[model samples]
Target chain A: MKKSLLFLVVTVFILSMVLSACGSGNTNGSNEGKANETATNQPNADKPKDKVTINLVAFAQPHEQKMYTQLIKKYQEKYPHVKVNYITTPPADYATKLQAMIAGGQTPDVFYASPENVSFMVDTDQLLDLTPYIEKSDIFNVDNVWQKGISKYTRDGKTYALPKDVGPFAYVYNKSLFEKAGIPTPDPKKPLTWDEYISIAKKLTLDDKGNNPESPDFNPKKIKQYGAGFWWHEPAVWGNGADYINEDGTKVTIDDPKFIESLQFVADLRNKHHVVPSSEDESSMGGYTRWLNGTVAMFPMGPWDTAAFWDLKFDYDLMPWPSNNGTWGTWLGSQGFGVSAKTKNPQEAFDLAAFLSVDPDIQREAMTMGLQVPNLIDMAKNDYLNMTDKKPVSKQVFLDVIETNGHDWAFEKTYDREWYDLFNSSVTQVWDGKKTPEAFVKELQPKMQELVDKSIEKKKKAQAQK
Target chain B: MQLTEKKKEMWIAYLFILPLLLQFALFTVGPMIFSGIMSFTDWNIVQKASFVGFDNYKNLFQDEKFWKSLYNTVYYMIGIPVGLILAMLLAIGLNRPIKGSKAFRVIFYMPAVCSLAAVAILWQWLLNKDYGLINYALSWFGIEGPSWLGNETWIKAGLIIMMVWKGVGASSIFYLAGLQNVPKSLYEAAEIDGAGKFGMFRHITFPLLTPMTFFLVITGLIGGFQLFVEVVIMASNGGDGPNNSAVTLVVYMFQKAFNYYEMGYASAMAWVLGIIMFIITFIQFKFQDKWVHE
Candidate 1:
């Protein structure tokens, strides 16, 4: 009887162990189901009474993060029944992390989309078309925002995202450097022509012997201060009335004579004119550091650097970019909020995206904090240009560029990433003086066109399948 | 009854090991098989994959950049012997009964454990063309230092130098342990027979250290081929150095996968790299008996 009892006890213990393990596994499976059901049902079934939680993600700078946090708080107070989980990722890792999250099926309801990413996101069918929502919104009028900013995110007559900011390039000049060089600052309203700008740059540049480029005894090797710095090829190319792509986005036109002329002029600034820092110097010291040390007189910068520039010890002001073809011209950068197509509550997500992007108060705050140039034209003209406490004396330059000179920053709608990579890699040779502009462009044009054609074909096939 | 008891105990043993076996199958082995299949398809992560058998490999064979990157990777491996020599010398120096030998070992090992990103950043500043400490020191000797990181001809050499400096410590530690294992009696017996220090090292010490040298060479070759982080950090603005001179096979694979969204091509490149590594390691093992003592 005792042996039978012991056997029964052992059997029961083993059975209990197996049953407990299986029971835990079943609970884990059910827990996942509960999470899915809650995520799906709560936003739709109990919309009137229960809170609707929506996740919003953005890659924001420090000041932008602070502005977004405040705006989100104001939004939450206005809509008590809606809960927003705002997430911010650093700019460096934002795209990679967002792409992984999207592929892994954990899409955020609303996210920030840069101009470079708009076509990719749209091509992948990740974004919700905002045209319907925009038509219904009484306050969100497209005409109120900068047209370039709005058009950047629009494709095939449908808008994928709302314009949050417009970044137009302008010259931010150090007043102290100009005074020290005994050169007058260029007028904000009337930009200088290329030759006139070069003459002024000659006056500003100085060698260790205090000889300007125009002086007979000047030595390029002994240069201590550069007159200007071109951060990218955009301002020069656009100012020359040339572009990388055609209007229909079907061809690469980088081999145009005007574009080659612009590139030659840029190369001359360092190699022939010796009025700008060499590539090695720029890479080592960086443009910002050179500007801070008063070694550079004029820097072509976007409006986003206004706050950082304001803290510099030297006095500074803005001016329109120097014209190459008798017209002030530059490129426009835009980034805005986009809603994901995978959202359960499309209406609420669209509302949050609109509030974050189109609200006049948020736009004004973003402008005042130097996080953006206001996307709203009226706010940009009146509030941004005439702000009482801002350090820039000529904020009107940015607005003027946006109104008259800004073009969509030379990116094609299809095959943009591939074409841009090729162009950028090829142009490095031009910038490094290994190849002339004409030779580089001639070699790059056909390669870029092939990619564009392939992308168009792929897009057509994708559309046909859909 | 006894057989039943043994059977139950065997089942319990399997139950304990099942978790580990399941983990290995799910995580490691599963990805290995999946990646092998993925190499034969055209996948861009977001799109559905279609079979494109052998096309990726064919394109890889014709790709100029792939050839260039492979050349650069082999160029980087030239540092292995340079590193091994320095490591062995340090190990011999430290193995002696000298003051603060323990502290010296710790100091040498520190760089091996230090963060790679931090090391790369430090080397970047040290190798800068204009304002680097190295150039400043060279200036004191009236010699203008060449542009180390910027010049295409010098960038790979610069990388190899940094790799050797960062890796020598760990390799030397292994050599030190091996040196300790060489019986002291052998050294004493050789000395009593009027053998010089050099002769004793040639006959007794060097022969026994062959196994350690063999281990270091095999591991070093494998590690040399996977060089990525240092180049990435040093050339963060653009991963490709001047004229793409610093581009390595793994770096190219990463760029293709993440930046260009060409996952299938990247997978194929990865598989090719894996095959190359396997063949090389197999060759080394085959010849191990000629050089390495038991």
Candidate 2:
């Protein structure tokens, strides 16, 4: 009798263990069904009576986390029946983490996404179409926000996400370094031409012995200071009116002569003119460090850098990028707040996304904290530009680029960036002076085009499967 | 009916191993089988898998980057032999009846226990072209060192140097243990036969150490081929290095799986790697009788 009792106990224990393992999934499914019933029965209710809990996932800095926490507190108070759980991940791992959650069937109600991820997310049906939500939203009118920010997420007639912020990459010069060199501070309204910019860079660059680049006795190897430290090739390419891809993203156009010339000019900044740090020098002490130490005269800055730059020992201000033909250009970065397709409460999810993205009060608070440029055009011009106590005295430069000059980088427009990554990895030879830009571009264009073609095929397959 | 003694003992043993068996089946065998099936499909993790009928394998065979990464992985294996030889020498040196030998052994073993991520970061700063300690020392001899991590030709050599520094200690410890097991009677017999120290090491000591050498070689080759973390953290441009020179096979697989979302292709590459490793290990075991004393 005791032996039989022991065997039965053992079997019961093992069975319970297995059952409990499967029980969690069942509970989740039931809860989801409950949420759906509540959502469908009261589709038009302004405030849900039943308790609704939503999850918001995003990558955030410490200050941004605090801002969101405060915003959520306010939101919960407004709708007492709603409870929100804000989950954060490091920015570098955010995409993979979010995708893993979706694959595991535990997608967040609202999440953050980048412009580069929009097409892929939409193709995989991971993003909820926000068109109907936006069309009916009183606060989220299309005319109120920057079209460039909104249009990045729009495809065909549907929008997948709403713009969280628009960040413009602008030129920032160290006031101390320029003043010590006896050069006039760059004019906020007027941009320098390429030739003028190069001349200024030459004057600003000095060896350890204080001899400028143009001086006969100057030595390139023992340079104590660099003039300009622009590392990205996007500005040079776009300012020269040459792009990596054609419109509609069908062809790779990096083989264009104009593109080759712009790329070679960037290389010449180090190899020929000896104005900027060489690749080797930059690796040892990065350009950012050099700028912080007052060795580099000018470097690119974005709106997200405003808070960090405030604590600098030296004064710095923004200016328009050097122009190629009376037009300056740089890359604009935008991250969006998106609703997950699997959310049971689309209305609640869209409301949270809309509040975080387009709420002017929250936007103003974020802007005041130097977290981002305002998404609302009126607020950006009237409020953000009027904050004179903020450094980067020429705040108008950020607006100028956002309003006209900035563009989505070529890689952001593509379904996948493998082709661009290939280009970037192979072009080091050109940057290192081992190959001519023209030869390198011509040789690599075919390989890049092949990858782009493969990406197109993959995209088509995904769409067909959907 | 009452249970018999044998049946009771067997039941107890089975109950004790049940948890382990369940864990192994769920975590290891389940994923292994799923990934094997995934290699033959076009699954991107988020989407439903579609059967592609060996297309992933076919495409992997033609991929130039795959070949380059495989070549890079094999090139890094050159460090294994070089590391083993140095380790053997260090072990012999530490085995001598010399003062501070205990301190020296502890010092050598320190790198093996250090966190790999931290070690990779340290090496990154040490291999910097203009300001690195290595280059700074090279400058004293009036020889300008090439950029170790930045230059395409030198990145692998730089990585190999770090790998050897981090790995040589653990192997030496293993060799030290093996050295203790060498029978003293054999050395005494060699001395009686009028053999000198070198002669004894060549004939007796070296032959007896063959089993240990064989073990280290087999394990070293396997570990060297999966080199990922150090290369990813040490090399510039998100681990691809300049001109894709430092991309090892595992790093490429990781890139495809995570960065590019080509999980099916990554799985196919992983299976190919596994088969190659199995074949190489099997060959090693088959040929072991010729050299291993045991």
Candidate 3:
């Protein structure tokens, strides 16, 4: 009896293990089966009697996901024969997960494309060139989209994706803090020069002893509040009329005297002027939290963060980026939807992408959610910036920056991820005050130039093959 | 008939083990060999892979970031000894028949069982420079705390402290089990020989616990070399800490693979790390017999 019992227990254990393995294997098999089924259904999709399924994936926050689901439902109603499988991945894991899926040959029919990933996707032939689709469609017009948003997804004069949103960096200031310090609120119409901005920042900054930074007895060590912070170097550099790369993008000009001076001015905000929090302080609390807590007077943020900032207890408003040489500037960030090259239904995928990007109703819904600035010029102005109930009180500043001062970074066009990794890693030292900007730029310029040159060569080689 | 029954049972056993063996072969062993081959190429996931001979390895040798990451990984191993000592001491203290020892054991082991991401976030708050619990406590004694996560000089030390806090409880449980296995008669014998508490621990209890020590040290070193999650959580903006102080070998490899899409370079890094781990573990096994009690 005991011997038989042992055998029975052993058999049960083995059976369970085998059953679990088969369970996982079955799921993978089913996925592959579905892919094959989709492929077969594509050709028959043109027939009025046949049904087709298209897979679409995106990374979105909870609110944004709900909006996307609603939009997809509307699209399905219009195209009753089409079945859509919408997948949403969280932003943190989206890139890695999408890359794995594409590499494994289960590419989504449509997916989100950002400036960072577009070049890689194009080079690998993962994205379908949408130039022909746009040219043929009566509803889709490339000129209707903002030029800034369109340029981000274009390569070699061919558009690959339609812009879903355009995020222009603008100055966000705590109005309550400025009022408390007895300073006049900054005018959105007039851009503050560097000295004027610094003087105001000095007044807003306060030490534990309630002394301003300009006071002779001000204690930097016991600072209770900071005046301002610029999140990225681009705003400071561009505001000072210095570009990191020359206009032609042939070489890095980070070593330009104007750029170096801008860097020093920013560094002095912490070290010498004592009007801004040190890097350590900023990392600990974050600029947004500090602004919400009324510890910071001014911070630069994109439109995407406006929704989150809406809940702040203190009064706040947006303004155009401050000017240095009568030219205000900030970086423009754009995200859009692209059709996959491996997609079985290119027409359906393009339809979905175009609908998500250019449709006025969907863009208005996104603006209402405070998710993004509308990518369409007319919609962004008439529907969003001119909206009566907008909370920020200066929502038009975002549109203004996009229309006048916004530009893409030099590396965005030619350099890939490797170049960015090199630049970001080296620049952190300068940000942390471990190295002077002059020394850092001088030492890193050659390395950055080499990466740019290598990228150009690789692009030429790929073009030759094509 | 008896021989047939024996053969049938043998077949059943193999059948039961087959699933587990197959899983191990498919997931673990398959990836290992594939990655080994991939390490010799110049492949980004999207691009076509081309055979580049030893170029990936050659580039790794010249990579300054690789060297810095290796240094950071080794530096992180300092937590092992610190963790082991604290665990052993706690285990010894708790081994005594005392009030509420069971509850204390559970309380201490809580951190080990808690979700790693949650624990890391908790530690970030605790180590915050301005209004954190540690600084708050320090202020009462008229001492200001240094910026734990912000300053490069203290970031590694801060990470080590967190590791010890999280690991000590689980490690002490292992020591406690080892302590239980030790014969009570040895302590009686030592007492009869007029041995004091220190003498008894040093002579009788300590020798018996060497096996557990050996186990923990070897495993700890392996775990130490792959430190990624805690640093990633603490430094969420950039996975690399201020001035790249907290970038370990595994984290760098992850950035290379996922962020840069350099599969070939990442694979080469993984193999290099694997070989280093093998050598170290081999050396440990060779030397363990001298100190580890049977």
Candidate 4:
């Protein structure tokens, strides 16, 4: 018993010693608080500016964070007078920690701000007015950004933030598959009219033709080959110009005539049209694998899906999202460089933001990953598409989607969160087939209006106190 | 007789455990006081917590999610107690003076040290619908297995099975310790009297192990209520666990505080859970007064 107790004591001692070493090894090892006196002194005679550090917090994945870190390091190298204090937060708990940082009076010098909480920052005047910064750096094209994203960020005609990706849905077909189906290529120039697209889908939908459309024996039900396969929701719903949230980023638009119509169209492709597979079928075969397995001829997705498709080793052709309202629309998402108003040096902060956002190399690397749409026009055409890098993805989709059918997607309004969740929750009712589209929309309208009014009053009171 | 001044001073000195008192005040007492205060207010990381008074507590009472989580906890309480009783029975059986009985003890204790997290995950794999050990074994019996974790009705059963497997060894150890204290003299006395093996066990050995049984039940209930790791990892994103059939209250509190940033609501939840746990332990103690041999 005594020997066992002694062994346990040594074990605990070793465990705690290792834990404490890991505990303090983080911030101190990063040399975060150290002053680079040698480098600061070398340029002292010519430039007497004191070196300053800027804290930046982000909720990006490791690879995405690595890109951001590389940008910061390059910026520090160029502008020796500046140092970057970068903190990579896990995507899950970023908002909680960020809020704590804000309440403590010292937020990151440059950090990611969300559309949902931008109003919170604006309410407290804790965000920098980027108007002047944008004017100074013409390379940061403010006008050419997707209109819908700008609509959400722009409160009372002042933009707050931009995104790295806007979820724009497109029909990616196997050019080889289309050729095998004997469906001549879709007009690359025009994409397709809604009628033309669906008719083509119906025609190319069968390996075991019951007859022909002309022969009155066309059977869509028991087709051996599919004309197109949709991954149920998301791009399909949003592709039809139906949004989850309104343009203001506040209200959910689930019951919108257009939105319900979109769901009906996809559901009809299964139930009514007998074209797309049922939810049960898709549940068994995962979306990525379904297309990769050559079971589906045409797959539907957003520009963000390019990396997944590239990794799957499929020969594919791209088409712009099918049009509904005479003209096609692409919902755009993009990321922006935001300078915290709490920065001790706002001008220096803006200068660093410019250096990071406007740098050709930084924009090039981001564009190569197909992770972000570069805010700059010139640097947007990056060259990492043709690399022998570990996993190289084509940047052409990012460029082409923007060049052809991309449109600014209006973000839903950001106001009362629960009220919005309730509206989004109501979609599950329609999805579960309990409520009709018209009734669901009508039933929830009053709830939405009441919450919107409450939000408006809350914002009014908050502003008045400020 | 009146106590001498030196005698009183020495006795008082014995009561003053300075280092322990200081440690208690700093870590335990300090946190308890702060948590009590926090329970009454909205202490979100953003913006000064405008004191919402009892609003958070009031909302928690009416929330459907809170009630569901409570139901889940009750399910586990019923489950673990029943399983622990079986473990005690097994330990008693294995404690017999038979060949290779020592080997059985080592085998029983092996699971006690195995990480519960790894066990939870491994059991989830075993209970998986398409490609699991349990279902695969069931296939040999020509039996079709249900989606254990995916289905709400089956999730509680799956969690119970995992808990029992992970927990059996620990309870067995406690039973073994209690069984050792059951004197051989009592058994010898019963044998001389022509009382059978069953007679001795029923009257004495079982009664004597009541102290250990009570301890296990109390600690097991407390530990079961704090179930989060398995629910979070195995269940869908939020431990809502498909139809929220497996959402324990503590998991709900974590979701509210961390996921949604409703700290005021979370604090109220934490206090409510603490009160529930206290009441449960109090009831167990009250019952133990009647039944515990020690």
Candidate 5:
């Protein structure tokens, strides 16, 4: 009797375990159904009654979190019903983790979105379309947002995220280094041409002997610090107008003469002119350290360096990159917000996205906190350029671009990775003097064509489905 | 006839084994099969996987960067074995009934317990070209040091050197234990036969240490391939810096799946690596019988 009773209990326990395994899946399905039903029927629900938990993902880690949390706190205060939980990820693993979350249908209501991300999710029907929510919002400026960020974020006339910052280029110079070298600073009145800039770099070049400029017998080998940095970088390619992809986002122009010339120009600063360290030196000590230590005199960087230099206690001035070929150019980058399509409340998610981006206070706060250049054009012109309390470098870069010619930053989700890799590889050979510009271009054409062909086919398929 | 005593015994054995079998299937076997399947598809986090067949494998054939990674792994594998041998020799030297042998063993074994990840950070600075300990020493020799990890030619060698310094001690301890296991009678018998030191090592000590050598070699090879943490902490950048010299296959797999979000491609690369490893191990076992005695 005891053995029989024990067997019954054991069998029942095993049965329950098996049933529980199956039961969880059904429970999730029913829970999703209940949520969807609640969302559909809850138009008249009071503000504080429907508590929403939005996941906020950012590419920038602990650094961005410090400032972004303050922004989130302010938002929570405004809408007491909404609570945002910020999930910070390392820049290296951001895309992979975000992808997993989307696939698992544990998608964040709002996440760090740009043309580089979220679009792939959107195409896969994993991101919610924000068009209706964006239109409904009173504070959202549709035209200004589109004019600023549409190039990078739009797919078949639908905008995914609003612009967050201007990641445009600037030429930052050391006032102390120039003064110490007893060399005249480059003219702030007129943008230095390539020839003039080289002359300035030469003048600023000094041996440890206090011999300012080369005395014609200057020992390049014994030089204390090179006058300029000639590191292999992306801005050099952009300055010379090397387009990685065409308007259709399905072509490569890396081997173009202008691009090849730009790489050669930088490489020559080390190899030929001896004004900079060799490729080995460039590799060993990256440009940022050299620039910081005053070893490299005038360097090219983005507006983000303004905050970096501001805290360094060194006298510095930021200038727009000089015309390498009579074109005033800088690379602009746009970052914005994205919504998950897999969310039970697409409308609610879209509402959160609009509030995060379309809020002018949030945009200005992001700019002040050094997150990015303000996305609003009028605001950038009036407020960002004319802020008296902060440093003037931010104003100068934007004002120069606005007055000269507007450059919008780009972000492509799928196509840029292959194209960027091709450009970097092809130009590296030319920079090393292993391959001629003509050969490099010719070699790249077929490979670029194949990748672009694939991209276009994918885009066309996406268009047809839409 | 339907259920004999032996059959019933086997069934009872299976009943006892079922929990472990289920756990293994759930954790190990399931993931292994899924990973192999993932290798054949194109997966990112957001999208459903699509079958890419052999495109990833084909691309790896053309990837110069992948080849560089293979070079780095191979370089590490080559160095670790030679280093372990030298360390074993060092172990043999310390095993003598000389003064302070205990102290020497502990001193050498200290690095075995020291964190490779922690030491690599300091080693990175010491190996720095412009302001590093190695260059300062090289200056005395009238030889200017090349940028160790920053130079393409020296980067793999640099990583190999770092790994060897950290790993050799643990192998030395294993050899020391093996040395302990060598029966005293064998050495005494050699001495009675008037066999000198060289012959004593060759005939008795060396031949007897083969099993320990085999164990260390296997562990060394496997450990060498999966080395990622020290390299990551040392380089301070992804695998692309310094002419892609520091790139390794595991690092490549990691970046492809996690960084680039090409999980399917990474999974494909991972499976090919697994197959290569399995073949190499099988060959090692097949050929090992000739040299290794029961």
Candidate 6:
């Protein structure tokens, strides 16, 4: 009886200890809340510029990492008093890792922000408002940078980040493949219509028996080469004068007939036309390698692919994406740097962000490395267009899309992208010939709309909490 | 009381275990209680939490994705039984006094020790629809192998195959040890009672191995329920698979908590999973007496 009593007492004591531990956790959470209140109350705690070490976090490829290392050396040379620490992780883990850091209260002073997460960051107060900083700084000119890049991270007249690079997509065709097929190369300035594009693709696609998809004896099972590889459906939808959302962002318009038509056309290329590779075939030899080996005649190119494409064995050049409505559309992507709202050394962090973002010398070096199209409009039009030492001789195609028709990706407007992700996963059925594009879009509209509505509601709640 | 020798020894034993007790109370018990409380509130880690009171749980019931994930998780448990049977057969086979049996054991055990990420990648190549070795072999029999990873209907089965292949080695080792524990006298007695090899295995060997089988089943079910890394590495798009067919409960919970920051909902999911696991294990333990021999 005494031993059991002792055990009960010990159990009670341990239970009390557990309760106290939870109580301490609550206290710690409230303490973090207090810290955030103070951080915002004193937005700029610019202590005497005595050697402050501010850290920046991003994800980059090896070459991009080397580029940043060189850029940091130059920046430190210019401002020797401020020390910058750059942290990089693999690209796939960057977003999750950055958010985890913020949650852990180890938020980096400066970090890369993509369009997809900028809204979420803003809703969470993770980003510092850059409008005041931009107005005070003379070196970082908003007028010089492309509006397409700058506008993505701006919300409610407040700029949260500055554009580091603006990636414009261009249609690149293998010149050797065209020559071997005894076909004339496409004009750089003009885009082919959907009908013309399909006919040309049929001619370019070849079987082991040397018959094109257009021939009676053509065998898709033994196809030696594919004509085109188009992974993204957004471009085709936009080119056909339809969009994922309406202009006011009040409604999802993906169920529009134009969107279904465009989707069907892309799907039919693989399922019906036998020009584009099927999902199974694409997996066997990835689209990137297929393009590299000259098995695929045409594929989309981004500014980021420039450096890698330079070493291709066969000749290649850029053309406009095929248009259904006399205007081509593709995504213009941007990655930017933002100062953390909780950062103590706001001034130094902002300076580092600006130097990395809009500095002419840095942008020029990045352009030389084929890392990006210049964030500066004038430089992209003149300097980037004149760099004829690259394989993609028609550089104007990239500029034309950035300057004219490229739209921000669909998910950029929302705080979260569950809606877009759901749509992408579900739409595979349409692409695989299991369902018609029209039926799939009709069935998916309400579901996608519901998720979008939920995200918007979440954003409103976040704003109200703030 | 202090003068009592037994009481003094008990106090010393308590003192020795005090550090471990404190650690458990502080970390494990504390966090579990906190998450239980958190499940009742709406908390985005960065934002202030507000009490929602079972709203998250109610939402979970209506969520199609939750149901899909749960179904997928239970579907993956099919590998456990399949793995156990294969492992038992392998253990029995390797128990023979044959040339290179030890080498064969090592060869089979290789997959269990290999890194999951590397193994998943190798399986991806082997399961590829067009150029895979599996499909190439099927072609010899004039049969076309279905797209294993690509089609929604086949993806779960594909994952089950990979999981079974990876798990059989470790399970067989446990069964092998259990087989050694079975007295050779029992088999000899069965044989003397006019039993053939199959009869001896059925009556003596299989019945004797029930305890090990029970232990393996419980652990395997628990492990199978938490399937995440293999699915993440194997599935093409961040573990969603074709039409989210490969998304298990734990993966969905992870996506909710980390990717979407729905901590309260994810906490509710974790609790539901915990409850399910507890119920299953409790039932298994309660029924073990029916099949398990002393």
Higher-TM-score candidate among 5 and 6?
6
C-alpha lDDT of all candidate models, in order: 0.80, 0.87, 0.83, 0.65, 0.68, 0.86
Best by lDDT: 2
Candidate 3: Cα lDDT at A290: 79
Task: Output DockQ, candidate 1.
Answer: 0.37
lDDT of 2 by residue, A288-368 (tens): 888888889999999988988898999899988887877789988899999999887798888888888888889999888
Error of 1 at A384 (Å): 1.1
Model 6 C-alpha RMSD to native? 4.7
Instruction: Compute DockQ for each candidate against the true complex.
Output: 0.37, 0.55, 0.49, 0.16, 0.32, 0.41
TM-scores, all models, native as reference: 0.90, 0.93, 0.93, 0.75, 0.85, 0.91
| CAPRI band for model 3 | medium
Ranking by DockQ: 2, 3, 6, 1, 5, 4
Where is the poorest 10-residue window by lDDT in model 5 chain A? A402-411
lDDT of 1 at B256: 77
Judged by DockQ cut-offs, is candidate 6 incorrect, acceptable, medium or high?
Answer: acceptable
Error of 6 at A74 (Å): 2.4
lDDT of 3 at A309: 84
Q: What is the TM-score of chain B alone in each candidate?
A: 0.91, 0.92, 0.94, 0.89, 0.87, 0.92
Candidate 1 structure quality by residue, lDDT tens digits, A1-466: 6446655766676677667766776773467547656855665564655457778988887777887788888888877777888888988677778777786677888998877767666777888998898888875787888877777888888888887677877788889988887778779888789898888888889999999999999999788888897446777888888888888778888889999999898888888888888766665677778888888888977788877787899988888888788786887777788899888778888888888887888887777777778888777778777785887888888887777788776663553366666576556577668899889888878878876775565465444434
**Candidate 2 clashing pairs?**
none
lDDT of 3 at A324: 83
lDDT of candidate 4 over A1-466, digit per residue (tens): 6445555755665566556555665544344434444544456666758777777777888777888778878778777878788888887678767776776565777777666666756765667876666666654565655454454456666665554444445567767767876778765445576567677667655536544232356664345555567534444455676776666555557667887787666555555444555433342233456677776667765555656666665467666656565455554444455678767677677766666655667766665665555555544453433443523233445455565555443323544354544454344344434566678777776666655654565555456545
Query: Which ranges in model 2 have alpha carbons more than 4 Å from their true place?
Result: A1-48, B1-21, B97-103
TM-score of chain A of each: 0.88, 0.93, 0.89, 0.74, 0.81, 0.89
- Residue pairs clashing in model 5 are A99-B45, A126-A341, A127-A341, A128-A340, A128-A341, A166-A373, A332-A409, A333-A409
